[model samples]
Target: MSAWIEMISDEDADADLRAALDLARTPHGTVDNVMRVHSLRPNTMRGHVVLYRAALHDAANTLPTWLQETISSYVSLLNDCGYSLANHWKNARHLIGDDARADAIWAALEARAPERVFAGAELALMRYAEKLTLEPGRMVAADVQALKAAGLDDGAILEANQIVGYFNYVNRCLNGLGVSTAGDIVGYYAENEAE
Candidate 1:
């Protein structure tokens, strides 16, 4: 499905917006529809690009990139956002490099029973993600304590928190705008997010 609103094209962008669009471009050199939704406000688009890169692609994140991709897919699934789910699932599959393993994880995520495939700190974080995504108001400090008890240090918990929050934000943006995987290349920007 196309966006519910009009999106600005590269031809219509000024120098500054053109720069922002450049950063958001897929490897195909075209802006993905989700990022294009922010074209009306160049600054917002730029912020999205920066946040996305840092949250999921930054080398400094202690969480493995594959795990981040899985977290993104999980959040999208919770939000019923096909665009982000399909895109990040593809990315996660490629990074995981084992079709069977990735499919098992996908199965668990699809079942909304992360415990089926995850354990320990990973399981705790997935549970936290579910609670935060589905019941933002019900969360309490006990959630953080649970993560800590599961062996996640404060830094890892924060990283997982940022990833969950980022995917929730992206999921709502795409869902609210009617973004879909129609013409976009699934996972095209996964490895090339730094541009």
Candidate 2:
């Protein structure tokens, strides 16, 4: 853990911060360590959590929950954030059910992923995410063209890009802040390891 951040000071929370925390507690079982630290600045943490949850709920792409989690793992791999990787990896198994597919997706992502899992449309979205996350400046007219070739309309592309960007942003924040990976999620992955 980074020496810079201390866990949130329970005794020192202001009224608004407490409210934000109260709101946060309804969904998350407990105040996560990362959330606890962020609770020191509750409003910001509230906004971040709200937006993240909303992004997950947004119905933009046709990818299944498990597949989305797979994409998230790929993003986490590139970002090198254990927090993001652990949660999404667990989600992939829990929501997607097919452990084989999750492992396959990870393998493909680590390798440059030639096969398209969702559809041509989702392929374009994943490719766009890879480009945006790995080499934003290198993205060019050709990238958009490829998405078009895969039959994604402008609206779907926009949503996909937003989701990718959002995850990338959170990955960076968590990485920089030294948030610990969830131990239960870590155990879940270990339990579900591919044979």
Candidate 3:
């Protein structure tokens, strides 16, 4: 853990932070460093928890959870945030339920060539995520039009956009905070959304 970060211990948490912390805890009763960093402002922690479930784990998502994790992992890779990459990659693999296929997809992503595992709208979404993460200022309407041209409806496009945006946000937060990767939490989005 970075010396700069003053993460609140569970014993020291106040009612407000404790409430947000409880909501963000994993099924295994652990809270990720990514969320723990928001201890100083518990509302942001609560917002982060809500957005996390809504954007990536909700049953209403038009984009599949596996794809959301893949997008998250890919964006994490682009941002050089190993914490998010490792965490979300595990979810992606579990949701995929085929390590071989998941490995191939991850390998392709690591090589910065998602084209090997995706085509059409899926491929377009990966490319868009790469561009959005690497060069957000350059994004324009044409980028979104390309997704539509590739076959994603507005709802799906919105989901993909939110996934990319969310990863970018969390990735920056994790990386910027200098969070330690030791004993990092996994299976964050593994539980069924119906739960």
* lDDT ranking from best candidate downward: 1, 3, 2
Per candidate, the number of residue pairs that clash is: 0, 0, 0
lDDT of 1 at 51: 94
Point out where model 1 deviates above 4 Å. Answer: 189-195
Residue-by-residue lDDT tens digits, candidate 3, 15-98: 988998999887778887778889989999999999988888789887877888889899999999988888889888998999
lDDT of 2 by residue, 88-180 (tens): 777776776667876666677778773645568667777788889999999999998898899877875665666677789988877787778
The global Cα lDDT (0 to 1) of model 2 is 0.69
Candidates 2 and 3: which is better by TM-score? 3
Q: What is the lDDT of residue 107 in candidate 2?
A: 75
Q: What is the lDDT of residue 133 in candidate 1?
A: 98
Off by over 4 Å in 2: 1-4, 9-12, 26-28, 59-63, 114-119, 182-195
In terms of lDDT, model 3 sits at 0.86
| Model 1 lDDT, residue 151, Cα | 91
Cα TM-score per model: 0.92, 0.80, 0.91
